[model samples]
Target: MSQEIQNISPIKQRILQFIAELGRSKREFYSLTGISRGTLESKTGITEDTLTKLFTAFPDLSPIWVFTGKGEKLQSQQNETSPLFTVNENIEDKLLNIIAQKDSEIKALAEEIGKLKQEIIQLKELLLK
Candidate 1:
């Protein structure tokens, strides 16, 4: 673990531990949480917005456990045969959903940038007239 991860706040440490438990890379956690790379890696504390997104993106995660780290990582039943407790497919689905959302956001941003560029061109034309 890096010194930065070691020095992070309690909640952040929990988040880091969660990430480690999942065996996911930092990039994967940032993608899943919709948290920016800089904020995810550099911040000492986890913001509410990031926490909200994290829970929303991964509903299987136990918020209580994430906040306090005193209980099971998941809130579902302990039985391995239970669908509620299954990990692999559910995690993959959640990650896919997050990736889809990011794709949509990127598309929207691209469209907005195109509109802004057109407006800039129109303003330039008016100014040059």
Candidate 2:
């Protein structure tokens, strides 16, 4: 609702609105959007890559509304009933969930790797002593 947000591109404003609707903080917005925290905070306008990521992550969101603010915030109810749309939505949700799980796994692995590296350094120091 700030003037800065209002002055930015419509897409960015819509993104902000979407995040607000979800009742998420900036940190959670970054997590949900899979956008880097620094980039989200620093960029005044949304990039094509970020937009693509946003749409891909939330298929139920209507791009028309996000880009032009002319349609419903969500996809039309007619599309929701279609078998193909439902299947695509299901696939996207599953994919996003899988990506989130993988990210957590990757973070845990990175921490373990760092610990192992430190232990190896300590062991090497002891051996030389």
For 1-129, candidate 1 gives per-residue lDDT tens digits of 578776677777787777888899979888877887866566566788988888988898888788777767887843455343335567778778778879999999999999999999999999999
Error of 1 at 12 (Å): 0.8
**What does candidate 2's lDDT look like per residue over 1-129, in tens digits?**
376565667677777788889888878878877887855444466688888778888898888888888768888542543332334467778777778879999999999999999999999999999
Deviating ranges (above 4 Å) for candidate 2? 38-44, 76-129
CA lDDT, every model vs. true structure:
0.79, 0.77
Residue pairs whose backbone atoms clash in candidate 2: none
lDDT of prediction 1: 0.79
TM-score of each: 0.53, 0.53
Considering summed lDDT, which 10 consecutive residues are worst modelled in model 1? 77-86
- TM-score between candidate 2 and the true structure: 0.53
Candidate number of the best lDDT: 1
In candidate 2 the C-alpha lDDT for residue 89 amounts to: 61
